[model samples]
Target: MTDTLALAGRLLLAALMFAGTAQKLASPTEAQALLALASLPPWLIWPAALFTAIAGIGLALGLATRPLAILAAAYCVVTSTFHVLMDDPWQMTIAFKNWVIAGGYLLLAAHGPGRFALRRD
Candidate 1:
């Protein structure tokens, strides 16, 4: 039951990562705009997409679970900066959401990947 729940949580987070990556690829305009707003290079979308894909797959496969979760949490905090700098209420909400997601990742990191993981540690 514990392993199952851990796998479920990992899968959910993986889905989020894949969905975000897909959105970036399918329609990059908004992401690019956000990059511009943050004074970051628009071309960063490609690397970001790649990172998400790799991290998502890693999470799904339960590979290097703790490290990946920690990295994902850091990624969330870093990305949230774009939304944090915005003056709009909606953007602020997004930033808060990112932080919450980061917290989840942190918990996952602390919990390990359970017995269902491909590489447990």
Candidate 2:
């Protein structure tokens, strides 16, 4: 039961993150605007966006979940901190969402994906 729930949670978060990354890719201008609002440099936006997309796919597929989760957690923390510190109203919700995702990633990192993951042997 716990494994099922965790798997579901991971899938949902992965989908959400992937969607976000897609949006960034589809509309770089919009993404850059948001990043600017958060005071992030323009050069860093593309790399961050790419990593988020790849990490989301990795998490969804249960491949390298530990390292990917750690990377995602770190990215979430940095992005959330940027949002909070910049006082971006549009990003406040994202900041909270990132924190939640960070917690989920950390949990997965510590516990592994159990039997529900694709990588389970």
Candidate 3:
């Protein structure tokens, strides 16, 4: 069912974002290196980490799924742009991931969270 698929996708993305945030938190130096490679402002590093973690938690719980997905999609877009600018061939991977995530977000945004969502009031 579409609901099942969406839930699975949302959970997967949440896990991915959580892992990324953990990496950033556990190894800030590595995070800094990647951010530097992306040319993102150093000050943004911590805020970005926090946003990703919070958004991931929200999406996983199906709470404000649409808005959180949108925020996550925006974050993915920003990071994808940086990867593209870096000329990393991995950018292609990031692009596809971002696109899929954005699609999921758009679907949730349009369809509400379907059944099985916390907001299914």
Candidate 4:
């Protein structure tokens, strides 16, 4: 049951990451605009999207679970800063959500991916 729960958690987190990646890909304009507003290079969206895709895949497969979870957590925290910069109140909510998600990733890092992982550690 622990393993099942861990698997479910990992999959749900992966889905969330994948959704963000898809959103970035489907409409680069919004992301690029955000980057511009943040005084970051707009081309950064490419690498950011790629990293998100890799993170999602890793989470889904439970590969390098601990290290990946840590990295994902850091990613979440960093991205939250961007969301915080948005003018919309809803975006601030999203920023807080990102921080909450980061906490989940940190917990996953501590607990590992359980027995269902491709490479449990």
| lDDT, candidate 2, 10-49, per-residue tens | 7876786798788777877876766787777777778877
Model 3 misplaced stretches (Cα beyond 4 Å): 85-87
Per lDDT, what order, best first? Answer: 1, 4, 2, 3
Error of 1 at 70 (Å): 0.7
User: What lDDT score is found at residue 60 in candidate 4?
Assistant: 93
Q: Quote the positional error of residue 65 for candidate 2 in Å.
A: 0.8
| lDDT, each prediction | 0.92, 0.78, 0.75, 0.91
Find the candidate with the highest lDDT and give its number: 1
In the range 1-121, model 4's lDDT, one tens digit per residue, is 9999999999999988899899999999998987887899999999989988999999999998888889999999998888885569998998999999999999999999989988888
lDDT of 1 by residue, 15-112 (tens): 88999899999999999999998788999999999989998999999998899899999999999998985569999999999999999899999998
Off by over 4 Å in 2: 37-39, 85-90
Cα lDDT for residue 71, model 2?
84
lDDT of candidate 4 at residue 85, scale 0 to 100: 54
lDDT of 3 by residue, 1-121 (tens): 9889878877887897898799888877866766787766666779978988998888788888888877777777767665553456676777777777777666666676657677752
Candidate 2 residue 106 Cα shift, in angstroms, is: 0.9
**Each prediction's TM-score against the native?**
0.95, 0.81, 0.80, 0.96
**How many clashes in candidate 2?**
0
Question: What residue pairs clash in candidate 3, if any at all?
Answer: none
TM-score leaderboard ranking: 4, 1, 2, 3
In Å, residue 63's CA in model 2 sits off its true spot by 0.7
Single out the weakest 10-residue window by summed lDDT for candidate 3: 80-89
